[model samples]
Target: MTVMNADEIRKLLPHRWPFLLLDRVIELKPGVSGVGIKNVTISEPFFEGHFPTESIMPGVLIVEALAQMTAVVYCTGALQAMREAEQEVAATAEAQLEPAEEIDISSRVGYLVAIRDMKFMKPVVPGDQLLLKVKIGRSVGILSKVNVAAYVGKVCVVEGTLSVSQRP
Candidate 1:
């Protein structure tokens, strides 16, 4: 298992700023699975308007963090497959210096298809460090299902099923 700091995470996911829910990737097994962390703070942008005096991290953001972690797994798997495909092509066929200019229409193969059976078990408050675990559940052609969970220490804060499709 390899750990990815925030910088590496930024390279993998397109999210930025207060929208980037993942603070760091705690563990990553490349194409197989990954886990990430999100630190809740009073200074978080949402808390100000959500409740000035007594604020809590929104349940939706917790879910988003879990989703982003899941997406990392998806991107990793797809990139690995893409690299393998390229290697196989290079090995068997004559290599060309010219790259495909069409933006590789196959890149849109991955997209989120569904978010199901989501449950919020507890409130995630300021100063809480959320640990998110996401794993590849099943794959049917270009579609894949990922099971995800978020925890505050030993307590489960949220859990759900995330379905992703490689077909545009």
Candidate 2:
């Protein structure tokens, strides 16, 4: 099922055109995990200079796509948690106490602090649709580790571990 389209994704993420790597999120489990899709096309600006004769999607961009997917998973999860917390607080509040203001979790941005064990097995070219998968790992304090992978059909093109942290 399509959990989030490009329009919805834009509301959760800050990335804009030409930079937003994900086209649609086919599967999402809030903060736990998610799968996103990106359709690479010849019309992409990077293709013009990456190789004028033969276009190839950069390996770094693949990694960036993976990171973006991870962000969506983590940030959305945080937003959900915040909403639940607010609800709980409201339910338990006394009549004399005023409801607390809503926190804008959407404004929180996650940064890729570290990327490890990255391996690119094949080159991604135009016309290929990349499937990005991200799963959350152990989290300590404000930092979280996620297992990320990118695939074209059944072939794994990129795989790595990404460490992400939210900015206060």
Candidate 3:
């Protein structure tokens, strides 16, 4: 149950400031599911124009945040699988040597190919802590189907399924 901060998340994802939405990944299960957080603030650039009088976080950005969280889960799972494979090889050879360096997975970030049954029940505003959760429902080759949802406390803010295709 390793936790990933912004720095570690950046290593696995290519998104930068003003774009990268994940604030912290609280829990991750390799090749399965993950839970994360996004702290919304009034300072966000989108809030400026999204509504001059009444600010609300855009629904699209919320979906994008879920995608980023999916990247964390997906890439971390791959990295873990790689390391385990390396360990197996090392054991078989009985080599008195350290495992190789961690693979650079920065470019492994995938593209969001699809979103299905998306729903937004409430608006996200400043001072809200958006909780993001995602589960990999199915994976075939380099493509995956992810079930995603976001919440503010116990209230569901958004729910949907997204398809991701890993970068080769």
Candidate 4:
């Protein structure tokens, strides 16, 4: 089990503020599954245009959040596998990467190529804490499908399946 804070997430993801939807990754199992948190607040920039009075969080953004969470799981798993392979090569070779050299995971990209059966069950509002969960379903080469769901206080706000393709 690997838990990633915002900083660690930043090191792995290229998304920045306003677009970086995930606040924290509570539980992660690399490519298998992960659970992430996104604390919605009135201060969110999107709320300004999404709805002035209602302050409803957009459904598309929610899906984007879920996708970002999925990326974390997918990328971390890939990073771990590469690291393990590096260790194996080091065992046979006397020279390896310098002490300061490390993998630059932020360059990785995951594209959301498809969204299926997505339903926005409830309108998300400010002050709500979203619980984002994703599990890898199937994969063919660099393309992978994921089961995604989002909840707020145990109420399912969104659920769907997303197909993502990775880019080097």
Candidate 5:
């Protein structure tokens, strides 16, 4: 089942056209793990500069796609936590919780802090559909580490570990 389509993804992420690499999320388990798809086409803006002669998707962008997937995982978990907190606050009768500052979660963007052990096994080009997979690792404070991998068909194109931090 599709957990999130492009429109829903846009609502949760700050990225816009030409920058938002994720197309659809097929599997999602909040902060635990997720899998996203990116259909690379000739119309992609990056292809224009990445290579005029032979269009090849940049390895960095593949890493970015992985990072974006990680963001979706973490952000969705945060949003759900917020909702649960709100419900708990509402249930309290005599003990009233202080009003928390309202922040627009939809507009929030997470930063990719570090990428390690990245391996680009194959070149991604037009018509290639990438499957981005992310698994959560140990987290410290607001920073999280995720094991990320991108696959074209059954072939692994890129694999790495990414460190991401949510904005305050």
Candidate 6:
């Protein structure tokens, strides 16, 4: 299992501060599965608007955290996809998480294909550590399904299925 620090994550993803929801990847198994952690802090800028007096981590951000980890899983399969495409573009491409990594951000977009049965069992607040675990469900063509669950210790705070379709 390869553990990814913030710097390593920067090399593999295109998210930045405020938007980069995950802190580090604790466990990774390439194409199979992965676990990531997001440390929620009172200093996060979003708290200003999310709630002034009693700030709470937004559900959207929690989902994005899962998506980011899922992206890692998606990237692990990128090389294989390139081979199947009989394309050499990815060969010279260096991995980086900056938004600029994608050649056409406007034209080629990563679409949120679907989200099913999302259940928020508890709330995640500042000082809480969100443990996100993602498992590959199935992939067909350019779409991949991932099962995601976020927990704080033994309590499951959120769980859902996220589907992302790659524009080909």
lDDT of each: 0.81, 0.90, 0.91, 0.91, 0.90, 0.80
The clash numbers for all candidates, in the given order, read 1, 0, 0, 0, 0, 2
Local accuracy of candidate 1 as per-residue lDDT tens digits, 62-83: 8788878877777777777777
Which parts of model 6 have CA positions greater than 4 angstroms off? 80-110
Question: Which residue pairs overlap in candidate 3's backbone?
Answer: none
Off by over 4 Å in 3: 96-102
**Per-residue lDDT of model 6, residues 1-168, tens digit only:** 449888877767778886988788998876668999999999999999889888899998899999888877667556445454543443446444234243322233356789998898887899999999999888898888889999999899999999988767
Per-residue lDDT of 8 in model 3: 80
Cα displacement (angstroms), candidate 5, residue 74, comes to 0.9
Tell me each candidate's RMSD, in Å, in order: 3.1, 1.9, 1.8, 1.8, 2.4, 6.2
**Distance from true location, Cα of 44 in model 4, Å:** 0.6
Tens-digit lDDT string for candidate 2 (1-168): 799999988988888888899999999998999999999999999999999998999999999999989889988898889779877777787355465576555578689899999999999999999999999999999998999999999999999899999785
Please say which candidate is ahead in lDDT: 5 or 6. Answer: 5
TM-score of each: 0.84, 0.93, 0.93, 0.93, 0.91, 0.80
> What lDDT score is found at residue 116 in candidate 1?
93
Per-residue lDDT of model 5, residues 53-142, tens digit only: 999999999998888888899888888888788877778754676776766776666788898999999999999999999999999998
